[model samples]
Target: MALLKRDFIPVSKQQNMKPLHYPDCIHLSERCGCDLLSISECKGESCSFCQSAAQQELSQREWLSILNTLGLEQQKKIAGKYYSGKMPWKSQQKKG
Candidate 1:
């Protein structure tokens, strides 16, 4: 069967799929990362609309764990290139 427009999720949508049990965040629909239309990248604990701190923390941890899968040198390179050697998550850890 041929697919319809609504039947096909964009690649961007596939990347920014909302976390399970995440709230219907206003920013999700307002500032979407997918086509800049459906939902914005989740801000986790930084989002004002986040309903549950525990859920946000868990989600952030999961995302961070993905980076941990990378080799130590590759991770360091990414940290230096993108994060200027100061990881944002580490700062948040200090704050929380």
Candidate 2:
């Protein structure tokens, strides 16, 4: 009896075989706040539509804007602690 050798490819290399482009969920129009064309040209970190899609549970853009007002160290601290416990919904509770 002869033993046969099997070839295996790693997942990381397999992923590079095809590039992924997600469709625009939030259509950018004159009514929408962001300029889709400009945002598309750069890395999508600051894009509101992309941010909202990635963090579906909360409003990422609003948090990002608030973080921007704080110092870099404070921003890191808040971001690290944000997921540690229940988020304070004081404002939302007051609204109702």
Winning candidate number (lDDT) = 1
Alpha carbon lDDT at 77, candidate 1:
85
Across 1-96, the per-residue lDDT of candidate 2 in tens digits comes to: 212222233448546433333334343333333455644332333444553344443564555456566786765666568845433332334443
Alpha-carbon local distance difference test for all models: 0.52, 0.44
Best by TM-score: 1
Total backbone collisions, model 1: 3
Clashes per candidate, residues 3 or more apart or on different chains = 3, 0
Candidate 2 structure lDDT? 0.44
Report the C-alpha displacement of residue 85, candidate 1, in angstroms. Answer: 1.6
TM-scores of all candidate predictions against the true structure: 0.35, 0.23
Q: Against the correct fold, how does model 2 do in TM-score?
A: 0.23
How would you encode candidate 1's per-residue C-alpha lDDT over 1-96 as one tens digit per residue? 211112223457448543332244333432333322344555533555544445567788876777767787877888899999866755555565
Which 10 residues in a row give candidate 2 its minimum summed lDDT? 1-10
Runs in model 2 with CA error above 4 Å?
1-58, 83-96
